[model samples]
Target: MKDSENAVDIKLIFQFFMCCLVAIVFLSSTYLEFSDYAQFQHKLKNKNWVQKTMEITPQMEIEIFHYRNHQSKIIFKENQQEIFSKSCNGQLELICKYIENHEIQIISLNFYTFLDKNTNNYNEFLLNTIAFKDKQGQLQTFPYMTDAPNSPQYIAEIKTEFRSFFIFAFLKHLIFAIMFLGFNLSFNVFKKSTIKLINNLIITTFSLSFISFVIRYFLL
Candidate 1:
């Protein structure tokens, strides 16, 4: 009877350690996702044009031409490879009008792409906006200058709710966690006769989190 009680205690201790490991992985993955999303948001708010541009297209170079008539043009190139060009009069005519009226001072031009990390896809990153110095000399961003129908509508609006961002990130990671467990369970990958259900779950969670970490570290 004493041996039986000792065995139970040992099992409980092992289970506790396993649970801790799983929790660490889950929290780490969520934090990584949240951090990346936060960094992206920070760039948007601060108008970190050069850093943001390098993230989307590391090889590309950006050039801006300010005309005497208060019009502007932005060009993207890659070592003689002309990638994209945008004139203020085209999609950015409203911005030109603002400049002409001296409502704002053009500080720099920037491009943005809405990246969906979960799906590993992104929308077109384009030079369709300008960062400006307002009357108070504060840097402000004017997003979605492009009139193209395919451009993301959300780009035109300002985002301030980071809580929603975190919630989305959490749900995304949860989905990945569930999928990982389902795949492993379907294959009976943890079918060891001695392993209990809780242990199996803990192991699966750790595996999923590790895989997620590796992918995010290398890709994002």
Candidate 2:
């Protein structure tokens, strides 16, 4: 019986080591992907023109497309206090009227495909946030930009949700399903004296993972 127990303990230790290796790979890959995404976002927000508009005839519906169908649409607001365009609609009205919240049909994105083309784009990154006023005159950009070490929200229209394409925000929350077990096992290994340390590790991991997902889903 003693030999059998010893064998089981050895197997468990091996499994734990394997898990650590896997976790290291996962976290490292996540960081690298995040770095690439940050660069793409920065290019988008640092273009020459922050915003522009195509003059639409009054009361016409405008179908806006950018970077190959990063899309949204709105009807032109007739007789409204228009800017730039012959008639205003879409993000323009929503922004000018001070519909300052994210109640409008706008997606604050953090990640984008930076094709080596399109130097004519009228957008740019001011302090990590992509600042562009869309056709509807709405202030466009991702809500939260962390490309810089200590970036803050530059505009007021978007709520600064800090979405990225990592999917950790949406999918990784379910990881708590199994993470707590890992937590418990780690705690038992230290004979309960390092319980706090284990818990902190878990919390930090989950928080980082959550932020990663937010950036992945919204930005990338």
After superposition on all C-alphas, the RMSD of every candidate to the true structure, in Å, is: 16.8, 12.7
Candidate number with greatest lDDT: 1
Query: How accurate locally, in lDDT, is each candidate?
Result: 0.57, 0.45
Per residue, candidate 2 scores C-alpha lDDT tens digits across 1-220 of 9798778778777776776676667666766766765564455455332222233343533333223444333323435532212112443444423323434433332332222345744333232222445557776663333433222233221224334434553444446525554645643357564765666777777677767555554553
Model 1: lDDT equals 0.57
After superposition, the stretches of candidate 2 with alpha carbons farther than 4 Å from their true spots are: 47-166, 169-189, 212-220
Please give the TM-score that candidate 1 achieves against the real structure.
0.31
lDDT of 1 by residue, 1-220 (tens): 9798777667666765675577567677777766675465455544322213432245666556688997787555777676666786655677656666777766555655555556866544656556778889898877754443232343233233344644555565565556444443443334555335644675676567556544653342
TM-score of each: 0.31, 0.38
